[model samples]
Target: MSIREMSKKIVLCFLLTSCTYSINAQVKDSLSFIKSKKMSDDDLLKKREGTFATGLPDFSSDPVTGFGFGIRSNFYWNGERTNPLFAYTPYLAKLKANVAYYTSNARELILSLDVPYYKGTRWRFKIDFKAQQNPANLYFGSTESTVGNLRLPSDENTTFSTYAAFDKARKTLRPGGVGEAAFVTDALSNRFRETEYMLNLKADYALGNGKWRIMSGYEIQHLSYKTFEGEEADAINPITGEETSAPNGFSLLQRDYDQGKISGLEGGWISILQTALIFDTRDFEPDPTKGYYFEIANEYSSKYIGSQFDFNKLFIQARAYQKLPFGKRTVIAGRLGIGNIFGKNAPFFEFQDQWSPEGSINSLGGKQSLRGYRANRFLARSLWFTNVELRYRIAETKLGKQRFAFGVAPFFDAGTVRDEWQNLNFKNIKYSYGLGARVAWNQSTIISFDYGISKEDKLFYVGIGQAF
Candidate 1:
């Protein structure tokens, strides 16, 4: 059936099932999920009945002295056949909490934390915990992992080789996933449990004509795995033209057969010192809807003790926007930036190589780049990206005295992954284009959906705005 038809059926089922509920409960569960262009993590936590909290002062009532608090617990899952690379491992749950507050004086702070737990398909409980404070200039929080945020490298050959090896080993050991075999495979042995933490501080100091902002932080991680992923030698019966199988049905004879075994505690700490220079040329004070924002930041980090990675990076992003053709409503904006993950020699980590294109901007899906693919689908040493957008305001209204606004935009994005600094090529860059819809809960929060397209893929992405 068409998506519209499917949507109609879902709405019909929901209405028929809960037509008699109270307005608050109905809105919290059904209406919020359907009416909102995009659902927030906070909403998901509430649905799951977990504790959720926000440190931002409240501005819902009189705006100046208001404070708000919220808590919820929710779990998300994806099965293998649905999303190959992601589901190929196991279906896991994420326990999350979020809280935020904003004062009348314009100071705002938000806290969001996530803890991974439970194993849906595999026997191991592979969990990861992450917490971050937005507007880092305002509060403190953890640094996010590059795993999901950064894109990785990709080549058809490399993709086939790595995944094919994994698949072949899985089929040989599990053989159609029967009983115990279903829970045991080369894929399952590689699973591990890890914890990551970061503390971020961002603040702005205003002078007579412009604003000066500073962002600094530190991060640490602890990875403990029962067994690292490795294959055993393939056992073959030379006399019978057949392969030898072990008691567990694994191919017993193969080269470099490394069995997955629980390794002791392996952890590390990484700290970064960061500072940024910003030039703000606008009419308004601390907050202005229309203005030019420019930033150049330099961050340095030492190797993680008892870990295998080290790097220093320089990040820069600049933005400009101006009123456009349509009435007083439409606006056009553009952003350009360069980001590099550089190291003296090879990386300390084992999974990705410096030239690997798995999680850099050159990869398929990522923030400010492609929306059709998952973030960090590809990785690489260094990357570059550029974007432009045209937006039009659609509507403005108040919901029971709560103000909300909506808008639509068309955007073009370009980026790439590269090995050495000298290997960069902008003329042969990869690009994507899409249309987006955005809704503002208040001035501080907005949710967006982008229906993006590339020559080989088309995707509908939902997240917070803007892409940059």
Candidate 2:
């Protein structure tokens, strides 16, 4: 069986299953084992669920709007493991989608699909797409352990449309996500503008029980002035979607259209090919209690791939999870990640340190990475970051027919950034710490609320699963 054959079987099976009745009343009692294995890396997470979802607030450095709302959902189904594409391995297929609307009249969409047990003894694959239009000023400078966003408050002349457009892109989002445009900043105007668009495909094959694997992917993206997205950036005013003074000077704060330093300022297609070697042994993925995961990869860009510039990217990362002795309910998790750009022509936007390399353009800080500080708060040519968290399961209970477990986590994060590798400093590291509570379903899906404080600022986030 090939990829096409496997897909056909999955579709046919779904059509057949649709004719069946709900099994809640019949099967609810059979899942006691899932509830008992609260701290174990059980196989339950891989089981099919009709549909699951969660939502979070989108907050930012802008004061105009305290927050926006976003929703994430996953619909799972059985995929044909017997298909040659999967090498007759067991697998599950799911569609993940997210849509968010912001007060700045900005919107974002993230969609993707996964193959069964991407980390299991089978083939792994994914198709990802993301697009966002955010117009806001970001903290972009050369510094360590510090971040500064535009403090330029809205004035009487600063109409609703102006502020709304200025705050479309938030400084941070929970767990995983997309970002808005980046506005250039000037002494008189703390604003700059940029747009982000991307699409990519990837596949990986396992070497041993999915512990060792090879991964490869390709992507095409555009990041530049909001105007390049071919959207009405100011014709009718982005806020009310009606004519306003937004087309004028006060409304258009700062537009530093330059290509010398920030390669994508003018915005064009950035194409790249990437490959990696992965080693993972976590008992479970979402909220692991024990095991280790590691990866190293190289990404290259050139005119041959339609990239505007040429460059090579390298990343080496690792993590470990441990369950305590007194009770498996108590666990500790830690991670170490480092990234480097080998080419001088690599676009600055591409240097953004991101949590997941499958599709990330930024680096260093954010809700999913370094909690306390804002996203993209710190970016250096070469840098390393580390995170640690202590999780304690409080107890277990039931919600209707669903199983639930509640817990808490106190976490700490730190990282070092330098203009170059030789400039790395062991004594200088930015730090942050915080506490959070977790609510899980079937002991697999985790929902969390965390409050992190750092030298720069404090951050509050609610999202799915653990940070790593």
Per residue, candidate 2 scores C-alpha lDDT tens digits across 85-134 of 12222224556677876776666788876663332224567888989766
Per-residue accuracy of model 1 over 320-413 as CA lDDT, tens digit each = 7666666535767777766656665323221121111101122324444655543443334555667887877788776653456688889998
RMSD of each: 19.4, 10.3
Model 2 alpha-carbon drift over 4 Å, by segment: 1-67, 78-91, 117-121, 142-192, 226-259, 355-362
Q: What is the number of residue pairs that collide in model 1? A: 57
Alpha carbon lDDT of each predicted model: 0.40, 0.59
lDDT for residue 459 in candidate 2, whole number 0-100: 79
Candidate with the greatest lDDT versus the true structure: 2
Q: Lowest lDDT 10-mer window, candidate 2?
A: 169-178
